[model samples]
Target chain A: MSILVSNLSKLYGDAKAVNNISFEVHSGEILGFLGPNGAGKTTTMRIITCYLSPNAGSVKVEGRDIQTESFEVRKLVGYLPEQNPLYLDMNVLEYLEYAAQLQGVTKLMIPRRMKEMVDVCGLGEMKHKDIGQLSKGYRQRVGLAAAMIHDPRVLILDEPTSGLDPNQIVEIRSLIRNLGKQKTVVLSTHILPEVQATCNRVIIISRGKIVADGPIEDLQRNLHGGEKIILEVEVPGGQSFEMVSVQVRSIPAIETISLVEERDGVKKLSVETSNATDIRKDLFQLCVQKGWGLLELHREKTSLEEIFRQLTAH
Target chain B: MKFANIKYIFQKELRSFFNSPVAYIVIVVFLVILGWFFTSNLFIANISSMRTVFEMTPFLLLFFAPAVTMRLISEEKKSGTLELLITKPVREYEIITGKFLAAWALYFLTLMPTLVYYISISVIGKLDLGPVIGGYLGLMFVGAVFLAVSVFGSSITENQVVAFIVSFLIVFGLFMLDKVLFYLPSTLASTLEYISVDYHFSNIARGVIDSRDMIYYASSVGFSLFLGTVVLQKRRWS
Candidate 1:
């Protein structure tokens, strides 16, 4: 495992911020740390990064204990905080160069390493701009570049793309996906579509605890209950409309049938199935025997948003 | 971990002070007011030493040092950059020390230009070099203590304004105790005066380098920095 957290807990006065949370991430895996506001995702990331010590638990990065050997653990991890902490007075190149030096990149390698990061994070156009002058998206890119300057084995980002335009969001998501191909990336965000587009595994956190953890497909399947089938039938006159509805609902796995609309005397029916069963074959057979004109038939898969709401809702 | 890395962070922080208007504004205001006070009270009074400037330094520090340090950790906390710094393989001490040294360097720079007063006194009057050196040393010591207190205040809050107010209150409280001690019983007043930061500063400003005075200033700075470290640790758990 690239990262291991066991029963980690943090308390603020009488309130618990992270309550006995445990999870692990393997090398080269991008794990989406999903949570609503105040769900302890940021707190948990802080603990793993060794910014805050856990009240009772252990975090190990590359077999090194974070509590006992914090400096060593820090050397193996790069963290981008939620608010994009940066010294606005400094220009982009200057800031990244400073980060590189602090990360102990050899003096001789500083130029080469900084250039590589600038290119990788697409910071060429704004390299000389003062951070305060850049737009929100550019500032976020600068923060990401700062994190990757050290080239650590693990990357932990908290709300990496919290406030960006739609175009910037796509750019950052693609950048994170590219980084995940070579490094272990653990990031938390409330944006569900970003997870579906970027992460392979998702961990849903709610109220300081993990409620669900698995592949995206598994989560969707578990929350959706069954497949959804839509059927379009041409029914001349209103005589065949009732019959078609009854016939579609009569199938064993077909749970409900709703008529979407009647356009030019063609009836559209939506069928919900019980499980993973595919009823299209049976419907095709019935249509052939009854000479019912079948215009269109397709299945509608469950989306990640529906699954995410199901997991995170209180 | 490496000396080179510490130096890197230290240099970057020091350079950043000059890269903006904030540092220039602080230095200009500090030198103008301090110079005006020194000339009006010391030079105009025909005093042969820097006693007036040295005497008012702790009070000036009650406000000036906080302005320098209020944003050190507080701004980092506000921007969410403290986490980035902590995860960069740098020890906590290195981070704190680098920032402390940067603030101290700027403080020292603000003090350096005031030496023209020393040069002017030497040229125009019969001066005692011993007390003059002693007064500068005492001022630097008191400034260090104030810097530590201000840094600690910054570590505890994310708002720079709150940090400034908190640090000012602490430093002002320490100075006020010296004057308030006169009203207490003899023994209690003497004991309280001994613990007062200004009392030791006065003794050293008079060209007396007592061992007890040195220990008092060192201990104050050490204790405050230790508390600041504890504050950072507690913030993590909370």
Candidate 2:
């Protein structure tokens, strides 16, 4: 089973909110939809969830055309909008039950399913409390619980962990990871760590188009394949600077070296290499031969933030 | 279109309306003002009929019905709940109807307390039950039409106040159209008056349950509600 979108375009007035973009998510995969604000992340999710229709495109869920068989698509998909979109007056159990009934769950299965969601989402404590009285984190859990109550095959969550504490964020991420084992999950968020923590694949969208789409590890490896090194040198005299610079440049693998800071006759240099090459050993040996005192040496990996910025800057 | 889904949505909307203070405030304010109008103007003035109450109802409905329906779709749009509601397996018409039915039911409840005016008129004088019942039916039919228009207005905007104002203008315009047509030539005025909602309502108010009048109000409501559904559909595309 899979979700396929081809040449999907949404135009609001003269502006194309979602340009001709396409991708697919297979069953039992967590696809991260990453984008900046107004980058059509929510719009794409809305179209997949049948909240909005695309102006030009075809959306197929499990090989069924969403335009012609929206009811069936909706039955298979559970959508959690960005704002949570819950009735604050309803308690957790009541809201879930309402969602279950709306999704065509049989009366007999409501109780069992409700219990399962309550337990899985950790809403047992807040099940009796009104949604408005619950904290933002608990409310987010309730939104997730509502989406899962009907046991749909696909789950689309928009910014699920937004406005949550770090602890709650981790807990929700773990819960999503557990869900990904069985359901095809599409999670949209601007928070990079949530995608790295939970999603198996990432689709980075920018300016209403897909910029990058692949497994997270592959994206990290392909986009930024390098181990950066930071070197702090304690020179006995000014003569050590010219020698260290000449020796560091002679190594063809070193991409660039920049002086970060120099104080008290100690110069800190940031050295970069192409692809996960370990230049720390090369730099250490060169420094020792030149009789230069090596104060500190470390390797730095390219962070997800840099990759996200590079992919979505346009 | 599922029965269970519609019922669930209906119950949820009802519970929400009751849980908030807005519904109670609206209902109480309607009853109090209607009660005062009936007692001070009709009873103390020694009028034996509900003519004064019925006469004042159309004007009262001009403001009150829109207030009841202004937030039905607008508030959902503002709060982003419309996305959640639409993503369910239920059809768009089901959501619209569920909210409309809830607001209509609340409006019907607000009308119930006014029945005391009917009873009081009957006790104090030899009441003409036919015209009074006819007037109440006309009031309800007109109110339903106004509610439909207000719901349509609410669906078009995210601001409840704007919805209220737009609906009020539409309802007031329809009410005044019949009188405004008098300045036109006889032939033109006759045709325009027939299309006016107030003209058909007055026909029903006078104890004449004309099929044409009933059809007019029914079609007005149906037409407005259909427009609301179309507006919502267009918004998705937009």
Candidate 3:
């Protein structure tokens, strides 16, 4: 594991910020940290990055313990905090140099690395501009460039795409994707699409606990115990809607059937199955025998949005 | 424990100080006030010594020290950059010491323009160089202690105005310690006088340069900076 966090817990007075959460990030994996606001995602990230020492348990980054060897761990971890903090009074290049030097980057590599960051973060136009003068999107870019300036192996970014426009968001997503090929990344965000677009694995935290953790596909596939089939059909003249519904309801595998729409003498029905079984063949045969014209048929898997809402709703 | 980190932080803070209007304003104001006090009696009585400026600086520093240090850590806290800063490979003491040195350097720079007072006095008359050098050293020593205390104050709060008031009160307390000697009993009065910042500054300003006074200034600066580091370490707990 590139980063190992085991049973880590942090308490703020009587409340818990991170409640015995444990997870790890492997080398060269982009892990999406998914949670709602105040879900302890940032708190956990702070602990892993050696900013906050855990009240219980421990964290190890690249074989170095965070509490005992935090300096070494900090040298290996590149963190862009949730707020995207930068010295607004300093220009982009100066701030980046400060960050690079603080991370222990060699003086010889700093200039070359700074150029790399500016190009990667698209900060060419605003390199010498004061950070306060830049737009919010541009400021966020500077924060990213500073975080990556030292070229550390582990990148922990919180809401890296926040305050970015559509074009910049895509650009940053691809940037993270490109970096994740060799570096371990733990990205935290409440935005779902960015995670789906950038991260290869995800861990959903809720109320200071890990509620969901897996690949996105596995998260979606495992949460759903049933499947949905949307069927558009043309019913024969003699068959009334009630009669056709009664016959369709007779199938044992079909759990529920609801009329989605009735337009231009055709009915669109949503059929829900009781298990992960193929019912499309059975439905098609029934439609043929019942003299119903099958216009469309396909299965709709549960989306990540639905899974996120389901796990965090209660 | 890295020396480079301290240098980086020092350079960054000092650069930001000059990049903004605050440093220039502080230096200009300090010079204007000191100039007024220095020249007020220069032509009237024809005194060529820098005695007036030296005597007036310790009291003036109660505000100057806090003004230079109010935003040292408080601005980082309010802007959330403190997290970014502390998470780097630097230790807490390095940051506190770096900022303390930067504020002290600004104090030194602010006092630089007053050299004209020393130069003009020496050129006109047989002015003593010993006390002038000692007085400058004494004022800088006092400035270092006050700036360290103000850093501690700034570390505890995220508001610059509150930081200014807190450090101003603390530095004012130090400034007024010897002045209020009559209010206490004999033994306590002696102890407070010995602990006061002005007692040591006065000893050095009179060209004494005693080891005891140097130790007092060094210990006070060290103790205040250590307290600032403690406050920073305690922040994660809150």
lDDT of 3 by residue, B1-238 (tens): 7788889889998988999999888888888888888798788778778888888888789889999999999999999999998889999999999999888888888888889888888888989888989999999999988999999999889999999999999999999999999899999998899789999988999998899888888999999999989988887666
Clashing pairs for model 2 are A225-A275
Q: What TM-scores do the predictions have?
A: 0.92, 0.89, 0.97
Candidate 2 has what TM-score? Answer: 0.89
Measured with C-alpha atoms, the lDDT of residue A305 in candidate 3 is 89
Q: Of the candidates numbered 2 and 3, which has the greater DockQ value?
A: 3
Tens digit of per-residue lDDT, candidate 2, span A152-232: 999999999999999999999999999999999999999898899999999999999999999887787788777678899
Rank the candidate models, highest lDDT first.
Answer: 3, 2, 1
For residues B190-212, write the lDDT of model 2, one tens digit per residue: 88887687898888889999988
Best by DockQ: 3
Model 3: which docking level applies?
high
TM-score of chain B, candidates 1 onward in order? 0.93, 0.93, 0.98
What is the alpha-carbon interface RMSD for each candidate? 1.4, 1.0, 1.0
Which residue pairs does candidate 1 place in steric collision? none
lDDT (tens digit, per residue) of candidate 1 on B1-238: 4677658767887898888678899889888888888889874688777776787677788888999899888988888778778778776667776787788888888889989988998888888989988988998888988998898899889999999999999888777878998689998988888778899988988889999999998898888887887776666555
